[model samples]
Target chain A: MWKAEIKVLLKKSVLDPQGQAVEKALSSLGYGNVQDVRIGKYLEVSFAAGSHKEAEDQVREMSERLLTNPVIEDYTFELVEV
Target chain B: MKFGVVVFPGSNCDLDAYHLVKDVLGEPVDYIWHQEENVSGFDCLILPGGFSYGDYLRCGAIARFSPVMKSVVAFARSGGLVIGICNGFQVLQEAGLLPGALYRNLSLQFRCYFTYLKVENRQTPFTSGLEVGRLLKIPIAHGEGNYYADADTLRRMEANGQIVFRYATADGEVTDTANPNGSLTNIAGVCNEMKNVLGMMPHPERAGEAALGSQDGRLIFESILKNWEGAR
Candidate 1:
């Protein structure tokens, strides 16, 4: 069994309305020091595979195929041995 | 026809879609959980719209990681018919099965109401029941429905006839106000290179019944069935 941790984020130039809303709310709460805020997601996936290379390949394929939107988001993954 | 509708934890449109297919269209359908891994047997797969994963992180961000997406992607890549409406469109974009990204409505508000769309290309299997330039009235409810793609990408889409729908008014006039989300070029929907995978922000399922004030959306499902039946 192998595990992969994936982190996904919107591209830098893309506007994040939810993040901006949270930032505004924070400012309203007097947390004025927060300059910039961006939001993203973290996912951990586990699958059974024969080797680290196979797991890595699967993880990469999954990221491109579904885990991340290459047009507006970027994703990276880390493998864990089980 | 055997159809599969993917259901995420926070998806509210699954039942709406299931009923739209099973009851309204009188077709057999199944509700596939997001964590399920296999989707090979279904004739069509639907990514119904809703606030998946409570719209956390990004609109369709978390839901994109669901295990069902793997099967969905594989199904689409194999030229299977897949439709993503509204939030489903966001998930398709977030899942990299379609081009462009959905930003918040230009006004930065959650918009919910009926809107008009122009059928841009009827050549695809999804829109075969409608003629090009026909107007369709559909409801759209979302905050992140504003579609954006780079200039070159937009040009390519136009050149390749990948653009399937554009926001329009009841009078068939294409205007910015008619475009609820301020999408680039007023695009409301597009398909992949194969034209089998469709992603559109308008909720066709919501407008399929006369009780909903319009049955124009039924043509889309009819189109799919007709095209598939002819192909087989």
Candidate 2:
């Protein structure tokens, strides 16, 4: 079995109000040195694959088609055998 | 002309759309279930506002994959009239029927109130009854109503007159203070290149009757009816 770990985030050009709000909260909490904060989603999916290449391909496809919205978001993933 | 209001599992405004068309406008209307694929026989389809799929994993992300959306897409491609309101707008964007995406409000709050909209494009079938620069009082309710499109896409949409509505002052001044959701350029609504498919954050159905504190929204239904009649 292989587990695909994915992180989805709004594109650099897109505004992340949630992230900005969190950043403000952190600043108020005395984390003034933190210059930036970006909020994103993290997911872990475990599935059976014949080979690492097949798992990687499936993960990439899934991320593109369903896991992330390309219009406003970008995603990165890593696959690990479990 | 017949109207079909699609009913997704979490659609709370389906009845509002149906009531506006059937009761107020005195037109034939029906409810189309999300699992159903057939969308023929309806002159127009309305995707009403609500928390579809409990707004999980993005507002309209999961709902865009509903079986009925496939037929909706085909219908739209054939030049059928389709309107998506609020959550429906998000679904349309997710399904790639419309351009751009809605993000969380700049204030990060669920804004629910009456707002003024300046009609930017009167050529769309949905806004033909109104004159250019008309000011409409409509209610918007959503946390993610902020519209955003890349600079290039925004330029093209402007050139194509696809921008249908914009948040504005009651006097018809487009201003940032009037923007309820902090949408780019204060955009309140937009349509596809063909102008057959429209997606808007405001709830016209909720403002269709005088009892609702505004009858300005009735003009939208009237425009649709008038356009349909003229075409037939």
**What is the C-alpha lDDT profile of model 1 across A1-82, one tens digit per residue?**
8889999887876776668888999999999999988888799999998999999999998887666667778888899998
After the best TM-score superposition of candidate 2, give how far the Cα of residue A52 lies from its true spot, in angstroms.
1.7
Off by over 4 Å in 2: none
Per-residue accuracy of model 2 over B117-228 as CA lDDT, tens digit each: 9999999999999998999999999999989999999999999999999999999999989999889999999999999999999999999988999988889989999999
* Winner by TM-score: 2
Question: What lDDT tens digits, residue by residue, belong to model 2 across residues A1-82?
Answer: 9999999999999999999999999999999998878899999999999999999999999898788989899999999999
Assess candidate 1 and give its TM-score to the true structure: 0.79
Error of 1 at B232 (Å): 1.3
User: Local distance difference test, per candidate?
Assistant: 0.88, 0.95
Clashing pairs in 2: none
Work out the TM-score per prediction.
0.79, 0.99
- Those runs of model 1 whose alpha carbons end farther than 4 Å from true positions after fitting are A1-70, A73-82
Q: Lowest-scoring 10 consecutive residues by lDDT in candidate 2 chain A?
A: A62-71
Docking class of 2: high
DockQ for every model comes to: 0.25, 0.81
